[model samples]
Target: MKTRLVTASVLLAALGVTAAPPPVSAASLPPVSASSPPAPAGEHGWVTSTLRHMSLEQKVGQLFATYVYGADATAPSAADRAANRAAFGVETPAEVIERYHLGGVCYFSWSHNLNDPGQIATLSNGLQRAALDDGSKGRVPLLISTDQEQGVVLRMPAPAAQFPGAMALGAARSAGAARTAARVTGRELAAVGIRQPYAPIADVNVDPANPVIGVRSFGADPALVAGLTAAQVLGFQDDAGVTAVAKHFPGHGDTGTDSHTNLPVIDHTREEWDRVDAPPFRRAIAAGVESIMTAHIVVPALDPSGDPATLSPRILTGVLRGELGFRGVVVTDALNMAAVRQRYGDERVPVLALKAGADQLLMPPDLRLARDAVLRAVADGELTERRVDESVRRILTMKYRQGLARAPFVDVDEAVRTVGAPAHLAAVTRVTDATLTAVRNDAGLLPLPRADRSVLVTGWDTAAFAPVATVAASFTARGARTTARPATLPSDQAIADTAAAAAAHDLTVVLVNKAWDTEVGDPRASQQRLVAALLATGRPVVVVAVRDPYDIAHLPGVDTYLATYSYTRAAMDTLVRALHGELSPRGRLPVTIPTADGTGVLHPYGHGLTW
Candidate 1:
């Protein structure tokens, strides 16, 4: 297939602009080389030398990492066809790989059958093999990376083990547990032949109204986030040798907007960054993280150019590399994201990103446009040949360090065995058990009536409270009448019903899931209203905040407020055990919750309870 080239002039015209463009100057163009070299014998040694040998077109190809989707290899959708025609003018992965010798690929789970682990392994392995086979220097193993941040951002489903979100881990506040989780997550990806995991989100969640990064972040405290990030990085890279990328740096946790849909402008200054956002990244880099993924948010304080961090030289080269001294590969968040593509024309982005010191231009919407632009820039002496080599050297160095320079091998069966193995499950249990804090227990309503009395259970996603049902079952077995209201209750109705239900039962257990709406505060108001109603019943009510501790202070009427810090199955099971007096709540609140509406004394980090 012939590649299509969309010039900046054409792009501007399409955008309804008729401004005269400046002449393309030689100093503004990428430099080209006349001679090509032979491949070296060492794994990535050949990669570095071959990178040096590349002409302008080949060098440009090295900068792009395009997005590929769908389960069937050949089924192209309308969007895919348009992307192929406009970007690289290629419809198939084989063609794109062969035409530009593209550097890497960022994929979605839609491309493979995730429900079947073996199939996922086969598909990803095949994609990697295909990239290596099409290389000019005889099989350059492409860096296969993905956004497997777990929880809400999880890429793999079913068979793949899903751990609690970063917020849950932060609430647990156990670096040891975070490390264990990372190792398990890394081993799982390594099994599927995925070399890099775009994870260990270093964003500190300060904005409760943050539409995107609420539960995805560790917490609001920068210190705790930095410590946990280092631990997670160590777990993934050191424990499993899987390349873990500390992402959305210099931090996406504080932003209220989602970069996937719109560009978010961070107003913090360099001093603010150094104090709040830069610590976790510095710690991660110091811990030897292999890669750093730049965010799309525009921080004017960091870069006066008014560009997203992904395309900002001040942020990528000046801040991350020069100031913070991160020597590893610097990868961009998906360039195709609306934050970039909707503003800067697709063709001009890759070249600018390369010049900005980005090693990888991830998920460019139009790979062909990016390829041709980089090639044209190189031909025109806009981007230097030395610059291309510099990035290629870094890439090669990382590969060599990862042992991918020697021999690349992935053990599929072993990966499946290690993903959610007994040890990993134990770690999850330990962390959840340690983190569940009883913020308020005025009447000592917990350790609910031993199987000798009647009890009732209720909440959101009521089915999730099955463990509570099991507890009730055990109580019934012990000659107690345990009735469970399986109905899904809106917060207020559930509370009211609990009160009415309490009239019949000796105790009422309200299972609460703190639902956060980005536009509103007090996600627990309904629960609070319900708890008030239930308290009027004169029944012992045990409240569990399944996600955040922010709701605990709002509803103190309940005898006990247990913060599970998450809604994962393991967490639920642990909560059930704790309620039945089978297990003690050993964990503490990793973050503080404000006492009064805006008092800011909820429960400071490191607040917990003993048996």
Candidate 2:
């Protein structure tokens, strides 16, 4: 009966219709309401009184969320400070706060080395103190945010308890699991004095070649993405009391180009857009997502001029605000991306975004120029003061609801305990284990023949696998001899050597961490070559995808295949347990795995095998 239902669901998903519902009904999850407007007294009185006395410059500043960086808790060295200034065009968080009177700050892994939870807490507390002390007169708390989207885009280093991103949750196929993952993420971030989490990417990844939003999105199914995203918003806002922002609005899941590098145009017609791209956003709004981040893509059907959504009133005001009935704040994607920078320079992006109905200007190329541009526009009547106030009202109302007005400071010690807590780690382990989907097991290669077989392990990682080397160690503990051939798509000569070594092994396990393009290296062709070489050895091989499940579509005629969805330690443990027959492979494939030629989908969205 279960097999028949699973087959039926897979077929339905393959046809792009809603599949059979999971065991846990999405309707059981509580809906998150839109943030209530600020009250007249007490906690809300501060925001109302503060907004009445703000100058035009201050009001404009409230709309900008600047970038911040810290090498370590000891404060950046002179050289590091200079490097930061060169990179972000801002001196420091304190300096940016003082000069711009910015509304918020976003920390990045590259800029802020968030390796230690204690250090992150210290940095956040100090910055919050600086924000409180700055004579902005209003004493409004800074909305500290980071890209803690888990999975592929983990910002914090060690103690953040990163989960297996969106698709993993989709593969788990439980709205309750989605809520738990997000709740854990929000709870840890809230403990660190970071009240705003710019996450729960609501885009439904319909395109397999979507370079930017592959694993970041929930999956290819619109209804599935809708349910998971709504649950995510609740986890962050309703459960954790953190301001959750549902992002890349309208949808970024079907594009082939990366918005960070260039503008990607979505050419879907009105009916097609309604069918594929718009459902998740509607669901997110229904769940009362506090904010929606605008995409950097151009949709011609919506805006005939071909302007990016970030600068189009037709899309933002006419479509998102008017049609969707979303009263929450609309934040722009980073202005530093070429889509905005190449077209309208840093000086004009914020002004245009404001006119286009964006409430927040996030990570503008130049903070000073962006803020000044908005102020000048208001003065010259290009933008009205009422328009600025509308955004300010929404921003201040959100902050108050997020608990910034009442009690903003967090105890550093408490923050350390909250992030990466044992319970949180345990929850991550459970979810990843449930998400270990084995799509191909034609050769019955799993539950290995013996504990003492010689094995070869290689794919994407450093020698140790960092926090956990459990995959190799698991086999070793069972008395099996294991050898690692870890390489970053080595030269032709090096590939030959690795292949020769694999040929000597009794069994081979190849890991493929292919997803979005990495800045440091290009291992595309080399990894494919390495896999081909290993398969040529005529030895039984097990291919485990540690990053993207789509890696299987490229390897034809392979006997065994598995997907872990991410490289987290919990995911690794899940892999080891499944390989040893300790855990059953029950996770369904979330996204459709396209054929190597990108012409067709080999494994549809809901296909998975269980022993």
Candidate 3:
């Protein structure tokens, strides 16, 4: 699964066979007809009428949604204002939208765009007011978006009622869990006036060594992943009114390289691609997912050209648009990524993506370069005005369908209380309980005596969530005397010290975390050594993998194993309760745990133990 690709075009061309993708109808999920979407509805009369009056520059502007670094829509403070100028050469995101007449904005924690629910709500309202005031003669609303995928990617982390991510939901094998999480997440975002959350990751992670899409993917089984993806899609749009984006199109699942850094290649032939990768996307489109984000990886089998999918017309126009019949917005994954940027600079990427059939350009390196390039492309006949209108119509249609056209603002006070509300967290807690997978309990150490035990909790700090002190406090509140020691690296000194500390406790519960990486042959060798050191004490040791589930594959000596899938507050809280017998370890394995060397399956999918 982690090997180089043979040239499909060279082989097929020599055989005198067409190098195009096999007839998509031959696939399990038959291709939907690539017919034109119906005209805008009566409620969407504004969308159609507004598009008719748009200038070339305005239409080009609507295709982009860039990130800005400020807490305010209009910078109210010197610090916030300076952040905006430094990041985007503007005083606020509002100014960015106005300067470009941009149709959308994206938020990220690194950009200081999210702090608290009230702040997010205020900024969103202010931005929307500004957008509505300036965009298309105030007829259109900005499509605000963020990568709030919850488990591994969450723009608003704290006080947001985060849940265990896709793989965890897949392990639960409950469409109810996926729908509940999506509805909760989407409603919270909508409450903040953010209409889009780039979520419901449709990539099926069949390769254990994939660097970017491990826990984000639902699982390795395409059929199961497809069903869950559709559930989240429906939940986000129909139930919550938030636009759900099925991401990393054509599957970024089997790559060893991170597209943010390097271009990875997937060599799956048409049949293999349909079986292992295309199901979730087909299901998402069938579920009426509002957007599909393109991957930056090159798929030689899909198109023999070396162009990345984001820049390949064959993949985007021919495969996704034609074979999949996705008439919704096509989102291009951050245009500044290495796979797209390494060759195509800021100027060429956006125009190429547009010509390739993408409707939106996200996070381009330079807003001026990207928007201007598309405008020039149209003027020079590289792209036609009709093509630009086609994309803008799609974008406007999505915004109107989501009710962003009718009511584009959220109540600040209500948004403050709605995000991370008690009801939402309660639902999240119940779902989190279902995602706890107990793979091994040979010593039956779980459900430990609450009052009598002196437990030691120590392990690598992944810097995800629910810090070790919080976990230890949870144990302490349960009447156990708990000592917490959390570390980052597993140097010899760190491992020896933690192992020695394990000797003082009646029970040792250590956490081992490892992220998917290109060099994943032994991604956590030092962490594995630390676990071995703890087991060397000859005491009952319970190992909890808080990030990716593949940690257990390399730690065969451990007598107890648990996977929380994510370290969100909800997950950690539920995990503490599960350890105390408040709930059972009921989640099954979503993806098979392959050996560290990627040579064999150490734990098959759906394998789990319950107390």
Candidate 4:
């Protein structure tokens, strides 16, 4: 079957489906040593041959990586496909391939349950089969990519091991640990047929008020973030056979806004940008990263035009390509995002992004319009055919670099077994244990007495406390009684009730969960009030940040604080054990927790306590 696909592709190419135009004046294309040890470079020799055989429409199709939704890996049913088509403004996967000759597809857990390894592999294989069977010139394998960043923004469902996010890795203060995390993440993703992971966020999370970046970044330090980012790239590429995309280039770390909600402007001067935002990317490019995802941000210092980096030639081409010398494929962070969509509209976004130097259009709201718009731009000479070929070359080169042309299929059963394999699960457990930073332990109150002390656990909702119950059970295992209840925020009565309940307990443990770093001023006002009530009752109140560590800085009055960095099962369990003296808290703060007065990070980076 493989031979047939290759033979058909070669024969079709020989028939000159699209005659090769003069080679675009190669203005020093990124160098690749065909003799390099990696399999990607070994296949570099085939890029041009494959490109020559592709039709003009096929070339354009390769630029757009469309979004798809279905029950399994195969294309959705006629009815279901219609709905997805209507939503994304495209036809069935078959029509998408036959018409657009798509370059790739991005998977979201919303449509495809990426947590199920067998199911994900099945979906990936089915998509590849469609692409291979589409009867195109090269039978180019789809570049299957996903947002598997592992910490706070994990897209894969369980039993994919959830590691401590980037900040936790920073807390561990080990570049080797970051590399291992990325390697495991990439290996698991590759096992499930994901060839690329949009991860190792290169953002140097400098602002504590940053709503989106919070712990998703490694830490507040540029050099530290750079080392970890470089390590992640090596881990993903060398160890996992998956390409790693260092994201939000020029930095999304300092902004108090989320690009998903609106466009953010980074007002840093070029010199400051070099000092803070550009290091991780520079390290990534130097480490031979094959792809970079653009930030939906405007750097007025870099580009006078207010266009975000995703569509700005000055940022993407000038800084990323020219200044940093990144020769790899540049992909945009989902075009459907309001940062780009509300401003340019669907048709124009992809066209402008490509013109600005992006090689792949990720999840554009309208696939057909984006593709056709690019085709028209080429025809109307708004974009030269040479520019299109440059992108196609880069896209094709990445497929080769990923070795997709050589081995595009996977073993579904193997993927199922390997994705959340025991060793990988254990690796994350260790990371979780390592990242439990103890910010404040009033009066050496930690290693909470396992016997005779009454304990109460409360959270914003019962569901949020579901994992905390495991922590409570750890107390029960040690012969202590425990009770838990929900304290939904913004209701003064609920806060008062929660306070009343905590006052009766010998020790009160309150769980706080705020996943994204979106800055809505005083997000913890209710929690603060509840904690204040607990404090007023003269009982020892221990605050646990189950997700974002920065939550601690908001409640300075809380004397006992702990950060788990994630709410994964292992993390929750580790926190329980740490409280009982079974596991010592080792993780330091990855980012600063600014004082309530916003004077400084109450506990700066690398701050932690142990008993």
Candidate 5:
């Protein structure tokens, strides 16, 4: 038997394919160079050549990075197979990748895709083996991606070197620190064969009430956010050999609504948008960030079509590509998000997003609906095969440039050794120690008069209080009798009982968060009442806003306040050290805290106190 190899010319002629105009303009895509990490300078002839011979279905797969319900790619259970079939029309993740000719796969905790570092490494390597070794023609390395933004939006579970998060980095105001954190995060990710991390959020968080991007954003100041975003991009890409995605393009920082639930319309005038929202993204592009995730929110100033940025040519192609001069891959936010899905439905949204300038359609609600629609569109000439090739060029260029072509497999032992190891976790403490801020120190009460006193620390959420217990342990080291308890509910009775308990201790520490979303008024009324009741006890009360620093705006009467910006373990360990004057509180406010009635600034963006 003789093995026959099909030539590129034969493949193109058989498919009747002509080169389609690439989505990005010539001005946007500079000459490619092996040295140019910022731009795919030389187009890596391999990428374009490989893209040319790819089948239409294979090329379409390169445009999607989807979610599938499975932990094991090679040995999926019956439940995983059924769930994957319902969502992807495939029985296993490897099968779905082979079926879709997928460019990437996004991992989610709920999808059971991430359990531990070792398991994820096995799955990632298995997916690569399926795509390349499973006898597929014109195969490419898989782009394994996930949201590992560290602090609040981490996809991988614990022992993963948790930090105090983006706002905390912004509070510390060190681009070097931001870069270090991204480097640490990327080290762990690359160890597991995951190449891309959707992080270093470029959205300049201007709206205090933004439910979606609160602590995820660096800060409200565009310059501050831009500096950190660029640092992070460099850290992840240049230092760690992983791609860092600057996201929700055109900014999701000013919206009060969350795009995960519904569409948000940003009303920034063109000039206002340029001044407020565009800076971080622009800086990110300048920093050579290869990927940018589109926002599901509408920016009327950029695109008057009322289309979300994810499905808007004016914003994605015109503004992001043409204006910002971005030539790299443009990945849309989850196509299944309510903002894009509700109006366009499952089938039509992927095509619109791609037509609107997205290179990769992420997390389409139904993979079959999205995959088939694009396949049909191309076959009908509704979309040109050339267009599909253009996107695949960008995708393949990324894989090849990142050296995924040469080394697609990872050592599972190395992954287990590197992720969440002592060195990474120790860095977390050093980073978080710099992020602890004291906005109010009434009566010079901090470093508390004595450490051998009774202290009661209370919070209504389990995650926030989990760290309080650790902080209490640190307090106990100082001969302090500390009580750490969680309400995990904002009921009036729970607040009253917690406050009553607070009266028994000489020092009462209240940990509060923005518990839930509300259209108006306080988001956590019971936490506020509990604070007020704690104050009435005539004992010294300390309040810490563990989630969002804005929790202080709702508690008007608290005398001493601190902002940890996140409930991550490193932050908790540092908090106790800061409380007892072991380490100085160094963090400044990243976002201003408004007065209780939202009338005036209680603590400005740069406010922080010392011992």
Candidate 6:
């Protein structure tokens, strides 16, 4: 039954019509003309003219930015693993442009070939041209957006440059470092005709139990989160000339549940929100952010009625528009997520969101249903024609501001050359070096012996140990026997394996990637148990955390704790350098770790160590 429903949905999506429409056919609607004269300056000339000429149906279609997964048609006999390209033919790009008159598209990594940079570039150019060519007004460029938040949440791998997660940036404690990272990220995205990056997550990491936003957020401090978010926005917009969207507003930092699977309600009071949660968003807006993506979480204090902020006029219009005074575009988190879809069917979401003051409805399940619903509402005077114009104006204003209307194509070679170049790599190195912290070092466990001292390493993903291999190679060059083995047993077994490995070694260096609810397959408990077992061997245990610093409190038995905050190659090298006494551990704990077991950890945001 589920398979049948899914097949129907896929078919309906392919046809671009999911529901029955009113008697007046949308097909009969007039096209927004290319020859339409522009309106006065500062008043969004194209939007005004386009709105005036657009039928009720066309006006409604402008408000939706729908989702297209993989592609439409399959290639002939291509055994390619690039599902996006294989499933969707090259002509599929042109089809989306002509059929839905789509305002924008969210591209997944699987949709384009990441390994072939040239092919990706070609595909991007074709998409842009298709969007403009099908439109009545040739000037309005389509909004191309992506969720490339770096680290584990990265969309494009290999050829596209990947940076450490937000926790690492917070640990670095330098706004300049964050900005440089964002600038490089933006440059890579902009190279492929992707103008908007849904990034620099401003969510302050308040809940360690939060299933989705652990390392994704900067830290738990409002002030530090605000500063880092602003720097990142500036880097993407001012420095790199790409649109930066500060997301999950009012804030997804405090929630314990994941919105992808369920509706997570933030029960904080209005006072608490104003004091802590709202600052980073306010700061980002002040920094001239191009867009703000609404969170799916419900805050009853903000709105007594149980409407999620994504579809709440009280939150979107009253707070964000009226109080905070954000004049830029406001996008909704993917409406297809369970948080929105489970409550309201896909058809009702467009009307509710538009009435709630959202400028764009992102990733709606059925674009045609949403488009038709909005059209019917406008025609019946439920959603005013002026309201449609207002949203269209903001969308166009953003496009113009992004210089997308003027120069659609970027220099692909220049973008590839600039992405993760020498200067960017150096910036990453400096930040990692500055942020490597030695939280506790009893009896001087660090600065291990260069000669005649065997080292037993365990924990962390072995895949991330490629750089460690290089380090081991260098040790081999220095005539030191360094044997690293993965403990295949359970935590206790792993400990036994480590003890066996360390029987002939002087020190046991356990590299632990702390498991948190936010990530998949976090081995926090296993790591803790392994650390305990390794300590039982009477060997000095130096534990290095490559993710969060919260694990320090979990594994207290280990005398020395090193927080690198990320497992990037550069970060790992920096960690190794600190261990060898080549550089001092200068980083401080950016977020606090609780001293007692279950003491309720409090990370007041701006903590970082200085050499």
Measured by lDDT, the strongest candidate is 3
Candidate 4 structure quality by residue, lDDT tens digits, 124-208: 7777777777765566778888888877688877778678788888777776777778878887787767888898899977765
Model 5 — which ten-residue stretch has the worst lDDT? 17-26
List runs of model 4 lying over 4 Å from the truth.
Answer: 1-42, 75-79, 88-95, 461-465, 488-490, 515-524
Every model's TM-score:
0.80, 0.91, 0.91, 0.89, 0.91, 0.83
- Greater lDDT among 2 and 5 belongs to 5
Question: lDDT (0-100) at residue 166 of candidate 1?
Answer: 80
lDDT per residue for candidate 5 within 1-611, as digits (tens), equals 11111211221121211111111111111111112112223557667656756788888988999877788986787898998878777799898888878889988888888888889888888888777754655777889999999777888787677777899998898877888798888888887888899998988776667878989988777778888898888888887788889999988887778898889988878887887788888888988999999999988878887888888889888888998999999999888789887667788888888888899889888787789999999888888988888888888888876667667778788788888899888888888889988988886888865546898878755653376677677778889888887755457887778778888998887777773232346546667777888899888998888878877766767779898888877787788778888889999887766655555666776789988
Q: For model 2, what is the alpha-carbon lDDT of residue 45?
A: 76
What C-alpha lDDT, on a 0 to 100 scale, does residue 507 get in candidate 1? 75
Error of 4 at 552 (Å): 2.5
Model 6 Cα shift for residue 256 (angstroms): 1.4
| Model 3 lDDT per residue over 423-531, tens place | 9989988889899999888778877665678888887665646457667888888888889898655678988998888877887877777732224455457777788
TM-score of candidate 2 on Cα atoms, chains taken together: 0.91
| Model with the higher TM-score, candidate 1 or 6 | 6
Can you write out model 2's per-residue Cα lDDT over 1-611, one digit (the tens) per residue?
00011221232347453422223222211121211234457745766787887877778888988676675423665765776677556566566666677788887767754657777777766676666676656666778888888887777766678788888888888888888888888888877767787888888777666778888888878888888888888888877888788889778877778899988888778877887788888888988888999999999988988789999999999999999999989999998898767677788888888999999999887766777788889889999999999999899888887777656667667777778899988898887888889989998777765556898877667442431245777677778788866756567887799789889998888777772232235656677777788899999888888878877766766779898878777787788778888889878987777666555558886889987
RMSD vs true structure, all candidates = 12.1, 5.6, 7.3, 11.8, 11.7, 11.1
TM-score: model 3 vs. ground truth: 0.91
**Model 5 TM:** 0.91
